[model samples]
Target: MPHTDTPPSGHATDLALLLTLSTLWGASYTFIRIGVETIPPLTFIAARTLIAATLLLLWMRSRNVRMPRDRRVWMRFGVQALLNSVVPFTLIAWAERSVGASLATILNSTSPVMVFVATAFITRHEPVSLRKLIGVIAGFVGTCLVIGPSALDGLGGQLVPQLAIVAATACYAGAAIYGRSFKGLHPAAPATGSLLVGALVLTPASLLVDHPWALQPSVRSLMALVALAAFSTALAFAIYFRLIQTLGAIGTTAQAYLRVPIGVAIGVVFLGESLPSSAWIGLASVVVGVAAMSMPGSAIQVRRV
Candidate 1:
């Protein structure tokens, strides 16, 4: 499979998608924070995956697309779903129970950096230059700066949940690289197939563990759960696959860095959370790091954001 070409509009579409992805993802923390308060983590995740899978299936059917029956394809889709959705979704949900959404999101922004690091070892196609390595380290350092104060503020710090978020990001990095194989297939096909497998794998476990029927949730919580499934899981992927097709993985993953401000803004506006001075410094560092990392290898220039 060939590498996805850069978007036709050059960097403009990339920037736009970056903004959109960041905003949607940033608000995600707020939504998860609210939903988890009312619903159990596993149950909430189950509902999310199930609803998203159903939605994707219906959308595919509407387009008259046939599901691939090949065992090898199914195997690939299963692995993609486990790495891209099921595992990360469960870990993020569980971690959110213990950590703030903003902090979790900041941790999640490490995906692109992970990709840089992972590709250095695994992928022969992409070159890893010293500048790129510096950018990767800078990106990680910036992410830590953004979360540092909150993470270290109190005793009994949220070390576990923070680690969980990092782990989840790594899963995504692995998925992004692995998904390069899907370049041969239509983006929507693989995305829907993965969602289906994710739903199938999660359903039985969800029933056994969550038994959602047993717990009563308020109207708001129920709405949040539905949104998580429909918007976060389904719509987000729909756009993401399109973006991945339009822009390469590095371009798509760049959205990770942009998501921080959106998450921080959502926290401030909706949750009334305030950012400390250190967080601002962290934000600046992250922005600089991401900008440095994402610049075209030829230019190797940093522009003010």
Candidate 2:
């Protein structure tokens, strides 16, 4: 059914949701770091997606909304699941094995940059304004600063995992763009369907490679896994789809800028993590860049019903 109501032209509500989403997603890096210590990456992601899918399914049932029956929609869900959940979740988990939660979050902040690039170069879905272009470049430079000079020196050895994080962000960028197709669908529908597909795709791989049934995970790890699935995945996607419907891809992805600071703070407070002076400078740069990118522009107008 086509939506009858107009989407809000004002961004205040979307901004609040964006902040909440960033906080949840920011904390996810910490949970991922904790969970991966006991569970293999593939197994961990499989469980997370499955748990999220179950929760979303239950929510849908409560709302009396049926899953989409169209095969084409399901196929799109499959692709979205691969890009948005399975691939990025696995890569981030794998990267966190070597990368600190703070650093991983910082690296993951590149998603908006990738989104800008994709939108300008490939999708052409939106025009590239001078401010947005500058903002993207500034954000990338800030990201490099966040990694600091010492980390750069060791970049050669950690190149694969670092690149893996970058690749994961790229997948997120792609997923954000692809997800626009679901704008007309109920928000919960695409999130639920994508998670279901992700779970199905990874279950076999996790079972074959990790034999999760035979493994013993700690209670702490179990708690982290639950939080990762419930708060970060299920609830996060619900808000994510809503933001996408109202904010468009670039605006929604702008949350990546906020995630780094929030993630770093979570790491520092809860995990007792610390960063160098350069990282602080880089963090400020990213915040400024994101603000610049998020400034009201002609290209950012959302379509109201």
| Candidate of highest TM-score | 2
lDDT of 2 by residue, 86-201 (tens): 99999999988987544566578778878887887778776567677667777767766765656455444677898899899899999999988886777888899999999999
Would you list the C-alpha lDDT of every candidate in the order shown?
0.71, 0.82
**Which 10 consecutive residues of model 1 have the lowest summed lDDT?**
1-10
Q: Which pairs of residues collide in candidate 2?
A: none
Please tell me which predicted candidate would have the highest lDDT against the true structure.
2
Using all chains and alpha carbons, the TM-scores for the candidates as numbered come to: 0.83, 0.88
Per-residue lDDT of candidate 1, residues 107-198 (tens digit) = 78779878876676667335455555565666666666655556545323788888888899999888877777765565566778888888
lDDT of 2: 0.82
Residue 98 displacement (Å), model 2: 2.2
In model 1, the clashing pairs are none
Score candidate 1 by lDDT: 0.71
